[model samples]
Target: MVRPGQIYKISANILKSRLQMTIRASISCNGVEIADVTQPVKEGVPEILNMRV
Candidate 1:
C-alpha cells in the first residue's frame, strides 16, 4: 500500500537516474548491443528493450 506521493516520487527518481546515467552497453559476441529492460519482467530471464548490431 503506497501513499499518495510515493508513486510520483518513485517515478521521478527513476526518470532522474536514468537520465543522469550513461547509455554504455555490453555487447554480445554476435556484436549486438542490448539496452533497457521491459516491463512484466520475469526473474532469471533477460529481455532487451533495444538492441544495435
Candidate 2:
C-alpha cells in the first residue's frame, strides 16, 4: 500500500519448514537496509500485521 508521505506498506508470507525455522522482515532503500524484524513465524499462521502501516 502507498501513502501520501511516500511511505509504503509491505507484507510477506513467512514459510516454515522442519522442526526449527526462522523468519525476518525488512525494508530497504537505495541498497541500504532501513527496517529489520528479527522474529520467527509459525507455520500455517499469518504473521502479525499492523493495519495502520
TM-score of each: 0.21, 0.48
Whole-model lDDT values for every prediction: 0.31, 0.51
* Candidate 2 C-alpha lDDT tens digits along 1-53: 32334444445454655554465656566688755565455666555533222
C-alpha RMSD of candidate 1: 16.3
Per-residue lDDT of model 1, residues 11-47, tens digit only: 1112233233323233334465333222333333443
After TM-score superposition, the amount by which residue 5's alpha carbon in candidate 1 deviates from its true location, in angstroms, is 35
Which candidate comes out best when scored by lDDT?
2
> What are the C-alpha RMSDs, in order, of all predicted structures?
16.3, 4.2
Please identify model 1 stretches exceeding 4 Å from their true place: 1-38, 51-53
- Per-residue error for 19 in candidate 1, Å, reads 27
Clashing residue pairs in candidate 1, if any? Answer: none
In model 2, where do residues sit more than 4 Å from their true spots?
1-16, 49-53
